[model samples]
Target: MQVSRTATKEDFNHLRIDDIKQPISESRFDALLEKLQINNLSEDEKDFFQSIVEDRMVTEEEFSTLTYEQTKKIKQFTSRSDLEGNYIADSSIGFEKLSMAPLLSAQNISDDEEYNEAIFNTFKKLNLSQDDGISMLNELGGYINQEEKIIFEDSLTDEQYDSGIRYKTYIGLDMKELVSKRLEELNQGLLETSDEDVKSDYKNMIYVYREIETQYNNIQDKNRVENEAQLEQYTRNTKPNPLYNADVVELYNNITHEYEEKEKKEFDELMDKLDISNLNNREKELFRTILEDKEISNIEMDKLSYEEMKKINQFIFKKDEKGEIIDDTLIRTNSRINALLRTTELTDDETFNQVLFNTVKSMNDIYEINNFLNPILNLISEKFTAFDEVNSINFITEDMNKVLDELIKTFDEHYQETEYDEIKEHYLSVINKYQDLKEQYNKTTIDS
Candidate 1:
């Protein structure tokens, strides 16, 4: 793999969590990010930076290496999963850290200079720096209308200067930090500003702050989903097993079907003791984070693999009538016995690592310990709800009052009037349907 000039020398626009684990000739740029005091990222953030680096999410110097077809393949994965659902699961598991999607998504490293130039030119035309252009994505980051777009130098007052500084920081700063700072400013202004207009401005600022906060949350949701997907890929690459949950469950059932009650209980006691459903959410989260956790130099499944632990819990294998692997076709694996051993007790320590575990987890559909839907489901649900709210207008082009009306209508028809059991069941069904649709869509995702 010859490193092209652009891939070798391109500045780190922003390093993603995924990048740190990737493999690219951008150590200079990555080192520069740390040196510049640019992103005060957390441990998880550092993991994302390493992932993209190790994953080679850096720019491609030679367009010849990746054609239009390749670029399309990359973009085509955007809808493969739901992101918002990921954040909800994270929050449920006592994870208070900011989501990874917003920051990670911005670090997309397309090698096409024309694409960046075109995007930058459009932003320049819109009277903002190239940085500000991406930052002001109504959905990715929060936007403030400023009542009126005040031109620079329109006022040198403390309010305008502070707001302008915020505007600039809004474009360049980490989202979570940016929101925290703005809230601090709002609190400060409450004590300092006695004027009505100034007070109103502060009030409007709350709404602006929330929008960005929501977006940041949504971005995190996306990161959760993408992380799961990456884990799925890494898991597939690492694991040697061809079996999935259906196969495992079938084996479990068949083992019982043929064995007597006493023998069946032998494995049942172990499985029941190590109930697969009882694992903590964080333990499940480890599989996805394990993929991003680059601090560990190498990832193998067998040594400390979550799958190996579960697979060995039963410690029994079903045999065919002739004592051969049930599926002879899969026996063609590079190391047939080793592959089968992955789903049994014979897995070796040599294969223990994040990458290998991830592959096994993916094939097994090992979700984060929380039984909640995938993160991608959460993001899509939020957007869908927002869209529904926007669309359920009795009158088109109505303002905030119309939003209130829609909310009133929704609350009245669904939550407010129903009996406890009926409404609870209905709400659960709706949630289930939302999740089911998300799963179906994810499975059908077209890989370009």
Candidate 2:
């Protein structure tokens, strides 16, 4: 009879670890070990293959016991299987490790017991299945690798650093804590004055600290909240006017109250100067009616009867060659002036008078009026730029506020004299500019 011989360790010496595949059943694993002559193999080689088979068995047993919810969570982390149809994690830690099982069981790259313990605690707190937690840890490893590259290679460009920080934030990793700890280490090293190379390293750490500080501030600003009271006030007051469906009225209302007392006094003085002696009977009656009121509010002016308005119009206009009233110029000029007066809170009487005088004098035609008004409109745009810069910092200087006040007054004075469509367009533009600046100021930026 022929004697049967079993394969020895030397017979399978050519085999490598890469030759092993997954979905390895107990019988298949034993067959593989026997074929490779496990009895004759060295201690380290046998332990390595045996550990792999044990890990595979544990993974299969744990997967079988998973609830629906746990299985669903695990599916989110990994959707594929190995060549032999065994489940595999989709992260950096390969299928052989199957999640973070290897990190928990074997030694880590850095032998820091505390760091490894912290990671294990965090894994438990996440409340994920063993496989899911392992996948998460593997994903986290990618971010840590990126951070290590940045620290070790000193390749922290703006984009790279931003991406790394964002990933860490998404993973709930505390980069701030890491930075603070590193800073502490550097500070401690600075106390020792003996080694020149150590001093140089400390100096480099200082530079790195500056970059980290800037990035930290930027992140803080991006997530920072604004004052709730200020935000509420801005929202309530910035609402668009229902009548005009625009913010012009709302914005004008906001600043015009500051000039009400001064404007009322000016209006009263101007009315006193008008001579009723040169007026017709009807005009005189209307003039007396206006003067009767101690203060004519804007609402009262808007509520005036058509008869009262016509009488005032007649008194202000002149007669032409056709014996018809020439009140077009008067009407247009006053409309412009009144619109401006309604919105402005000008304290300078002389400047206010000059603006009115120039406006009335230039009213030969619409073209002449526009020519006189365009420069003032351009000035409003410039003032908007200045206001925007100040507002961005969440505070306005007295000088800038005053400049804006004067500019608004000038613009309001001339706005109504131009064609209604043209004036409305310019008014909307100014309002839109103000709104845009206000929005920019309200937004929370990383640098705030």
Q: TM-score of each candidate? A: 0.18, 0.19
lDDT of 1 by residue, 174-275 (tens): 335545776887767756654443355455555545644554454445545678866663332212222222333343344324433443344345334335
Stretches of candidate 1 off by over 4 Å are 1-173, 229-448
The C-alpha local distance difference test score for the whole of candidate 1 amounts to 0.33
Clash number by candidate, in order: 50, 4
lDDT of model 2, residue 434: 37
Among all windows of ten consecutive residues in candidate 1, which has the lowest summed lDDT?
1-10
The Cα local distance difference test for each model comes to 0.33, 0.37
